[model samples]
Target chain A: MLNSYSSADKVLLAVDCIIFGFDHEGLKILLIKRDFEPEKGKWSLMGGFLRKDEVLDSAAIRILDNYTGLQDIYMEQLYTYSEINRDPVERTISVAYYALINIENHNAELTQNYHAQWFSVAQAPKLIFDHDSMVEHAIRRLRYRTSIKPVGFELLPEKFTMRQLLELYEAILSKELDKRNFISKINSLDILVKLEEKDMMSSRKGSYLYTFDKEKYDAKLLNDFVLNL
Target chain B: MLNSYSSADKVLLAVDCIIFGFDHEGLKILLIKRDFEPEKGKWSLMGGFLRKDEVLDSAAIRILDNYTGLQDIYMEQLYTYSEINRDPVERTISVAYYALINIENHNAELTQNYHAQWFSVAQAPKLIFDHDSMVEHAIRRLRYRTSIKPVGFELLPEKFTMRQLLELYEAILSKELDKRNFISKINSLDILVKLEEKDMMSSRKGSYLYTFDKEKYDAKLLNDFVLNL
Candidate 1:
């Protein structure tokens, strides 16, 4: 049965992950130092060639877990790059998946063991072989996805201050949005639960903390509504 | 050099086109009857295996031209379907692309030669090999793309009435929209040129024909604005 596809050309398939993390510094992307050649020791996305028996989604999850030691992260298939020479040694088509992980939750020991480090999106180093373009595309997708669905919360702590949410949006959009307008728009969505607790570390007068209402957020995702901030 | 990637798995790559066309009856999709083994004689999306030397974009264009004899149609890469059994015979990953063409512009001879037929989106057949899912995804993408960009114009004739435009949206969305609200929203975009001539086929009063202003539409596409109805 395998011989039936002999007349057809077969190409190597790879999955690359763009892991996005957010912290006090703003949006950051996880990068790895390539441990093998063609571009050994250079910065590139954490990736692996797909095994013959593996599905694309599983291959992506496996790659993410190998680098971050995290599971069930918010990952989405961004785009497929098929430039003939995208892989220097072969005609490989790479499907890029972007994942949003809370910076505080990733396994630090595993990250260091794999030489994975987080760099501020604005200050990311030059990446190898279309990885830079992949990162740029991921950011654009993150911005668009954040506007429609509350996926940015994946990059933040479980309980976060309004200032943190605003900063997350500002960083994703790469713009300084009006605080009042941002708050008003988010409030209108009614998918955040205000808590009595406050984050006292930021200032003498602490800011109130809030958490996402998953049920409401999930319901809102079903309807087509735009959070134009 | 190619032997270096021998250990990596190679999979058959295919391109499936969800060709969308719009006529007086509303949005339709072009489907073809498969001619070869592995689901032969079944109605399926117009597709072909990607050649080794071709990029995905060029492969999609070639497939579209082969089936419809149309050139430069507005095409977009929708998504890649990689289920292990998507193709019963092998592990073939298919990149799905959706193209919008003027229904009247396609070559009738070519379509007939290939036994291609356009079915209304609402009444499309149960296609072969996860193609039904592909069609559904294409429609969802078309709705989203039409909202943000004026790509719906590609499905309509060069000159059409406001009624035709409204019906196109209504069909793509599979719902009736308030005419007044639809017109007001579209007019606000200011990307249409109201012409002196009228399309009198639908009504005796002869509704005025309108053509899209390419420069304005292209400029508006660069901005982040939604034409929500």
Candidate 2:
């Protein structure tokens, strides 16, 4: 290779993931206690240094997989943070990715092995370095993504009740939405298919279950639609 | 410094900018012919390697200023491209930023010095490296930003006609929008202040010009609104 860029300064690159999961409780984020210095024992997003031969997307996937033992999760690159001293131990530019995974799907053993735990996004601990800001940024991105993409479905079970879907949006938006208006707005997008199945656990009169119509949802994705919440 | 991350690999980071500008002709991007080795004379986005001491945002601003002699332009980080060998000269990861500028405000002399020229995004020649992909990504982001934020105003003059605004959206969306629907949707945002001043360039009766109400626009930005183009 021609050493054309030899004069350029090189810096360490890190990939960090904000793993968002949803449950009956609310929106949650997976965090782990750092096992090594300089911020050992402190809560931080699952992260690792990017290897020379790895692409950033792969690095994020690797980091997430290493922590959760989950593969093919819905992940999107949120933003890159390069605050000069964001990583005090080195000059590191970290690319932050946000992943949406069904809360029930992660391996409990793997998570426990890494000292990883899920905390409600509203109640997550003050994280180390710039991670708190990263989480805040990721939440904002998640809320925005909820409007344009069917990403919320990634955090829900294969079959979900209307109330569950509404709760998921409310959690992601961090606010209360009128149930009627929310359902109407969501239905207007024409991405959900009402299933004959019902969940008897939530009410005396069970509520109907619905699953995202993948074909229509994908078609809507290609021709973007706005869902005013 | 602790050097706790001493074993981590270091790679060169580059900041490339897609400078979007608008005029009577339509939407355009600023491109420069590479004067350096490997891809000399090939058109590419204005870019530079990030310095060790500089933050990524500062690097983006500095690169933009260097190429256009413009400052404080509206710029946002779009995405980072790290394909291991995206740059043939080195293992360089580039953070792409999209900048919106008024076409008339750039320093023509400075641009000429760097062999920079404006090309309609639709008609621009093939760019070197992964820059073509970078431009495409930036355009997608710019469209997303347009719906949530009043960033489209950055590419327009301080005062513009309703027709000009419609044309701007059409260019960014790459589709002709219904004039009535576009006007009503924009008026509903209530972010524009119609002025007594009129531009007679396109019509004998003259078209009323409007400017963004900065306070309302900023407020709307804080409480995000959707503008479906």
Number of the top-ranking candidate, with DockQ as the measure: 2
Give the runs in model 2 whose Cα sits over 4 Å from its true position.
Answer: A1-4, A107-111, A221-229, B1-4, B107-111, B221-229
Model 1 fnat value: 0.39
C-alpha displacement of A45 in model 1, angstroms? 1.0
* Candidate 2 CA-lDDT value: 0.79
Global local distance difference test of model 1: 0.78
- Candidate DockQ scores, in order: 0.39, 0.44
Best by TM-score: 2
Q: Model 2 compared with the native: what TM-score?
A: 0.91
- lDDT (tens digit, per residue) of candidate 2 on A1-229: 1124878899988999898887767789889888788888899998888988899889988887887676787578999999988887777889999876667766554554566788998888999999999998988777666655556655678898989888877777777778887787778778889999899999999999999998886655322442110
TM-score for chain B considered on its own, for each of the candidates: 0.87, 0.88
Worst 10 residues of 1 chain A by lDDT: A220-229
| Candidate 2 CAPRI category | acceptable
**Clashes by residue pair, model 1:** none
